[model samples]
Target: MPEKCGTGLSLLPDVPRPNEPSVGRFGEVLRQYNVRLWAGADLVSVTGTWMQVLGVNWYVLQVTGSSTRMGLAMLVQALPVLLLGPYGGALADRLPVRRILVVTQVLHAVLAAALALAVFADAGLWAIYAVAAVSGVVSAVDGPALGRFGGMVAGPARLGTALAFGSLIHSTGRIVGMAAGGVLVASFGPAPLFLWNAVSFAGVVVALLRVRVADLHPLAAAPREAGAVRAGFAYLLRQPVVLGTLALSFVLGSLGRNYQVTMAAMSDGPLAGGAAGYGLLSAVFAAGTVLGALVAGQRAELTTRLLVGAGLLASALQVVAAFVPGLWAFALVLVPIAAAAVLLDTTVSARVQLDTREDMRGRVLAAVGVVGSLSGMVGAPLLGWLSEVAGPRAALAIGGAVCLAACGLAGARLVRRSEPAVPAALATA
Candidate 1:
């Protein structure tokens, strides 16, 4: 109304501007916020990875009807990571992380496709297991490089949030893929499910290709001592912080984590529901994982309190979930289970990222990865055997008890020492 009536002195309507400074153009968001489109694409491909994971486990059980066999199958997948994961991390640091990722992603895609075709063509169980075993070996190389690239893409400033976002995407993908897998198997059998996984691999491959080198530091080859591998271990041994966090990973990976296979058995046997029940159970738990990831992103650091507390909480959740009375009430426990696992993971990874030097990031992460899988290798079979004889509940009970005790003893001491300065942070516990 008072517009520059005569001399451009009119009052203009106030345009709302962001309280924050200009974030620049759309492309700048990815640059400053560490929001890479390729990361999203890679996550989409992981959906397929989770699908194969479900189908393979189900297929093994279908053939053997033995919990031990199911565990053995998992053992095969994780075994390579136990033995070679650190070496994998070392290689990631030595070479260009980007190039290594490209090669690994392609190999992984090929293996996934091969498995799909084999199952679709009526191949044997041995063939499926063989592919899984071989692919597991390749993952030792792929996973560490992939992990390093996460920090590379996001930079150290946003490492925690980036990790959380990746976790969120991956967890959501797993839930969607796992549910789709259960339904697909019932309707068209596992063949098509495997095929879908194969196709999904291409998505990640393209994403990897699209990422620019300008965004990533070249991971050049480094010549270290004869015992370069042991170097990482040596570093960890000196630092109780890393050692304790790693110990927690080992315990959780080995014992506290075999819920998927156990849940499958429990759903069918105790809950008296079939595939639908299994799928629903899986989806709910994955939903918990997604929620945990979201919660993790908002946090600033993975303090000592978080490391120990999350471990204790996870152990307790496992125990409670096993004892819950009806299916609905029982399923609700998965939320905490998922949340605790993410917290545990976030605590450890963020600690490593925070503490490790830039040069050793790959090697240290590799060592962490190995400890994680090896512990799982040992724990999974034991739980499987326990499940077979005493039933799933018994296995869960024992695993849960062991996890809680370990967290209380080892984790408590470590957290107390690491976090005395900020006593209140122990609420993470």
Candidate 2:
């Protein structure tokens, strides 16, 4: 059974309920009409997003012909999330999430279309950079709003299952979109792929409009006020489990999960596999994430223990990957490494959502977005430099070791902390 916090919301459940349906929890969650619709639309939307991502990266590389410039393009894109994530979360908490989502999706569609037009016009790299920056701003709002909206669509009781399914949807979309984007970009160009992404956003907009408001489990909107974002941080500080999980998430995300940089380095430098090998490794990693999401979706609950354990597993696997003998062996190692990465990611996300109050979920997830952006901004360049200076294998080993240390420290601190996981104010409420 899960423990209820002061807000009367249940935290992570430790076991399956006695009356859980025979069809299985994941299936039961999927049986809901709203869940099905949301899942389907989200799948299409994510697939398109990944396709656009592939197209954008490829276009930037082609225009600049320099990996450093390509990285700068990505960094510009993440800046908005780092700067505006808390405000975005505050918006999610204060307004109707569905409305916010609808608006953001429309903006996304327009932006993608604009990018496609720019590419078709043979615009310079400046157009790509500008689009990426604006898109990031939209996503700063969309990301937190979408996170809270999932809870409403599924309701509180089934949120875990819904989120797991969300992860599965993302991984599936990544594989399909990347593979298709690769083929299409080779044949057509980046413009068509961006247009396809623009169309994809419409699927989500339609899905949102069709969902029944009556079926949702909406929280009372937080009153409009100053310091809402600050209050969100205060709330997080008062919860040990959520804070600890976020800390671990930062470490794992920043250090252990830069597989894009690390894997490319391995392929070109250490593994001697080049572009073909890099593509193979990426595909393999995507398949692994799908596998991990399927396994995670079946679980009845997520816990701090599971989060830390997954991180530890992934860290260990990364270390092992650093020493693999050749390209084939390196590719073989990435499967379990990617699996553990998704499991850690899924667990951390579920824990953050489940442990926070309903009204504050968006803000907390906004914090999550900030952490993610920071990790990418900080980690990518660091790892890239490490790969350059110390060798890709050493970069991998050092990153894994750092994550392993962080996880161990987190686990030890959890054991030593005498306070209950719930905030004292919330516990007494």
Candidate 3:
């Protein structure tokens, strides 16, 4: 078992106390062995996931030469999450998270292998679509379970730092994976990348097995009950801050963050930089996310003001990026845009996890997942259609404008209310 801190929380020996200086909290949280293990595995897994993403998008475009088709592929993937995410989150609340993750990771691996096989066989577009849908089904459960597990691994006191570290890992993976995928796809094809992803899941499974379960600060598993999904919604309706943040996330995620659709179109169309340009943009954006994560990790607390501010900044940057004349200029603009995107995402996630009750965390996270899926479902196709009609630049500008307006309204509301964002009950929790 981990030793108890002064706050009576179970903390690893390396975890800093609440009263400790916050200057190096980012490094301090990582000193926990389990955190390190989780980070290492997450890096590998996320890298693979990004690699698969690049491969799928590129494959679809190469085959059909349509940005609309690329968006349709993304829409298919998000559909299951939109439909089933609540049930997945409810399952996370009832089950052992570590166990659930192990199963889901295995399923992900199997699905990746299936995609690889389909690619190798020169299967039709339906094969790719089917694999994407199945993967989304796995993700609907995996996302919520993973979110809840992070809290258990780091404990509430260090959760903010831990989540920031998670972003760092994810971004690092994106950098490596996107860069490599670009080079590999140019020389080979998407099949090899899919195979590599299938193998990456082993890293996470091994890490889960190695973790000391006794050291985790797990919440009591909620009992099986009807209306469990509705219960999560009811809980969120009561927390104005969390509910508002989710609403903001839905808009930003749909409009401000459909870069996969936009970037691919820009690369193939106006920029004429092709696969290499898209990869470079993806990598640069991820590098910015790394910087943003490091900055976010240093903070001891997150607030609604910070969340809205980050979203506002990112939205402005998106509009700037839409007008860059050349590929390199576009890529350069993406750096700060991606950084602010990370800040916005990390703030919203931390606020949601910190403000919710332990038992309801999974369900709330599931709702978050559903929002993301719904955003992708709506945004991907819309952006794709817009890119096809007015062009990629117009799609970017319009999306950015919408996000900017939404964030502005949300920030103004926060000022007018002038009430504590964190509820008294949760603030004490």
- Per-residue CA lDDT of model 3 for 133-212, tens digit only, reads 89888888998899888878877667667777788888888888987987888899998889889999999999999998
Off by over 4 Å in 2: 1-23, 415-429
> Candidate 1, residues 328-401: lDDT per residue as tens digits?
77689888888778877876776765555555667778888788777766776687778889887777878999
Worst 10 residues of 1 by lDDT: 1-10
Flag clash pairs in model 3. none
* lDDT digits (tens) for residues 244-290 of candidate 2: 77888888998899899999999999798899999899989988998
- Top candidate by TM-score: 2
Tell how far residue 66 is off in model 2, in angstroms.
Answer: 1.3
TM-score of 2: 0.92
Error of 1 at 428 (Å): 19
lDDT of each: 0.69, 0.81, 0.81
- Root mean square deviation (Cα) for candidate 1: 10.4
| Global fold similarity of model 3 (TM-score) | 0.87
Q: Is candidate 1 or candidate 3 better by TM-score?
A: 3
**Order of all candidates by lDDT, from best down to worst?**
2, 3, 1
